[model samples]
Target: MNPGSLLAYRHVISNAGPSDAAPVLVTDTFPSGVIFDSAVGADCTGGGARCTIDRLAPGDVITFTVYGRTDTTVRGTFVTTATVASPAENLYPDNNTATAITTVRIFVYLPLTLRSYRP
Candidate 1:
């Protein structure tokens, strides 16, 4: 990734339980050095800061695509995290959270000045 460049990320959430999971909510906070842009998916909302998914069901798999741009001065490693939860107890909570990392490099150009002297 490069500074001022657009970046896209995807998050997948699945209900592996035998029973349905209702009123599910999925959230992802924008990582530092990146500005939120937009997202797409079912029941998806929120942009320019975070993303949210409103519901899910047993054996349901949902994919979310989030768009963002790298800050003009951003560099180094950036990590983004997403989590899924519901008021109902999750039989397996270990897979509720996911994370992704990206490296950014910025290129800068400087002008050179030259002068000639006569003896």
Candidate 2:
């Protein structure tokens, strides 16, 4: 199988409040087809929640949506910060440039495994 055909999935983590954040960095990248289907903590550092997923492939679209509980104080936030590498590989363009993933909406409540082709 081609590496471009692999599926990668990860929970985009970052600090949020008001002012500038301390920069919640993502060190590793997920392989294509692997879905992050489990509840994860809102903490900058991954903890508490279980990070689990089935699997997926590239070219697949994983949509995310978020909902806040009634008693919850602060609403949960989700963000994606990844850029497509050079060569202008296999990617669907919205206008002209590579697909810009700003944020995945958290609607399912539970953590979901999202799949995308690896390259």
Candidate 3:
């Protein structure tokens, strides 16, 4: 992504349960180099860091699309982490956290240099 460009991230949350899961909440903390732009499939809060899902049925998956504006003043790889949680107990808690990585490219304009003139 370039500076001041829009970067999009998709997060998939699944309910691999034998029973229906309760309301799920996805919280994503965007890196410092990105500002929260907008989101879909879920309601955003905490400056687009937290998203809420009404509920999830068994074996159902919900995907949330998050948008962010790349900060023009920053560059390099920025990491955004999203964590999902529900009131119901999860057997496998290891996959609760996910990360999205973004690398910002800054174009550098250089002036023409005259090293040697052989005219």
Better TM-score candidate (1, 2): 1
TM-score for all predictions? 0.79, 0.19, 0.84
lDDT of each: 0.72, 0.27, 0.83
- The residue ranges of model 1 lying beyond 4 angstroms of the native Cα positions read 42-50, 111-119
Query: Tens digit of lDDT per residue, candidate 2, span 25-51?
Result: 222222222223333332221221222
Q: Order the candidate numbers by lDDT, best to worst.
A: 3, 1, 2
- As for lDDT, the candidate ahead, 1 or 3, is 3
Model 1 deviation from native, Cα RMSD in Å: 2.6
Report, for all candidates in order, the number of backbone clashes: 0, 20, 0
The candidate maximizing TM-score is 3
Which of 2 and 3 is ahead in lDDT? 3
Candidate 3 regions exceeding 4 Å error are: 46-48, 110-119
